[model samples]
Target: MVVASRMLFRFSIVWFVAVVSCFSQDSSQTYEVYVSKNLIGTLIEAKIISKDVNSSKKILYHAFKEIERIDSLLAWQIPTSEISKINSYAGKSPVKISYETYSILERSLTYSESSNGIFDVTIGPLTQLWGFNGDEEPTTVPDKKAIDSCLKLVGYKDLILNSNDTSAFLRRAGMSIDLGGIGKGYAIDRASDVLKRNGLTSFLFNAGGDVLVSGYKAEDQNWTVGIKDPRKEDKLLGSVELTDKSIATSGDYERYFEVDGKRYHHIIDPFTGYPASNSVSVSVIAESAERADALATTVFITQGITGWQGTSDEEFLIVTNDLKNIFSPGFKKKYHFKSIK
Candidate 1:
């Protein structure tokens, strides 16, 4: 009887441990990662749906490599990239680009044209002149003379693309292309693709606040992602449940310069040559992180009911400068947002 009783006690303890482990697995398991690059800073947290803690390290390494590739391609200061090559072709014939660079630049131009110039990639010179390209201090706004000179060089129409050759070129020498607004989110999408292809059953990857989610939690559990409150970093304005989707946020809060008590953010209006003023922030939800990344900036720069009317097939959820949130009709049903006080 003593032996039998001891056996029963051990069985009970085993069952208890099993139950506790199950509960812990269901809650969420997130791994922290720090990657140093771009002077722009990249922070990401990945939550994979599994109890095996060892897999987290592998995922972190994979993500780090993916982000590094993006940084190299999109970093404006990096003088030996496809972006720089395109910039060099300015004021000359269209410079042929690699297949990869041409694809991204082509998509950028499409978004620019589709949004009616709200998402211009050719605004680099103006962005730099305004000191948004990591400049330490604000210079006076570029005068009408400077802007008009640059405007001649600006214009998506002037961006020459050869579909047959898969190359891109700018019409003027002073013209430059900066992918700052959209590159990270595109990188997040690419990284997520790598994870999924590698058999990562479920994962969430966020570059800064641009987020992409794939698969589900353990055994069919959905993933929940919180949209950061633009006004308060510590607060989450809302939570969205996703099985496969991407979320990207663009806001005046992301990066900016201040002069004369006015804040000039990184999202510049291609038409006005100034930081867009309509919305303080805009968050977009789409089927792919790439589209979400580009549209968030496009929506912010456009800033209105029609900010992204014809940009892409992807849907969106946008928050205005006044804190009033807008959602594409289809996207409205997907999540719950905390009410603003």
Candidate 2:
């Protein structure tokens, strides 16, 4: 879980969309910006191009409300959340959950299975063990025995969902689930739905590093989003022009603690119960923010682009731990990325 203060730092190293022009030369085509600092443990920013100011403000309000609802339901840190109930009832009995929570869990399980447990939501135990659960940061590396113990409780296969009762059960007593890897993307998608339903065609919605854009930023120009270089604070690897698409980036810089010149990030491997070291950063572009978020984490945990076997609809840019940049053929062809260094 990213805290509000750390989320600010996370945004600096993660990707950022180019700011939409507030005032268009044609006064009739200006955009309204909406920003919220207290939602989803990170910044929520949206720019909508609308003619009716009242309607757009109302729509933005509802969009944020939708995100808040999700955070209340799925946030593991919240004791009243459904996720907490499921964790509390682990190995005891099934805990009834809302449809939204159940659906996201089901979606998470799909990614877990497809990624061969590389993207497991059952990594909650490992997260807590390493002190990366936003409660505290680890001063020293955890013992191997402790990591192994946590690994025992970290398997997506042990999570069971019952559609008939709309319930979830964790087979092990200490097993837990954290939706941090994919929840923001789901929320962003839901918010995007709200804007589209209100008949807004052009918008840019970003929560943390999860971004979804629609229509155009201007008359004929697509939105340009910068992909920050994970190695540098104020540098970008490049930018991509996108419309009607979603992009997400996961990097080692988001949350981490250093000990003896080594950095251990929050993106832990469920199998090893330690930070995944194959990739320094990974950015994924997909049709939906949900998929992009999951894929970004999945590739980072696996072997970056070399190990990825994604579908036709997906493209990726991976910065390996060796400081090498790997771009999927489709990504290179479609984005036409130029060197920014």
Model 2 scores worst on lDDT over the 10 consecutive residues at 17-26
lDDT of 1: 0.73
Over 51-107, each residue of candidate 1 has an lDDT whose tens digit, in order, gives 555665576577668877777776667887778877877887776667777788888
- The alpha-carbon lDDT assigned to residue 338 of candidate 2 equals 65
- Expressed as tens digits, the lDDT of each residue in 108-144 for candidate 2 is 9998888878889998988888887666667878899
- Assess each prediction's global lDDT (C-alpha) against the native: 0.73, 0.87
Candidate 1 accuracy as TM-score: 0.81
Clashing pairs in 1: 90-172, 90-173, 91-171, 91-172, 91-173, 280-321
For each candidate in turn, the TM-score is 0.81, 0.89
Please give the clash total of every predicted structure, in order: 6, 0
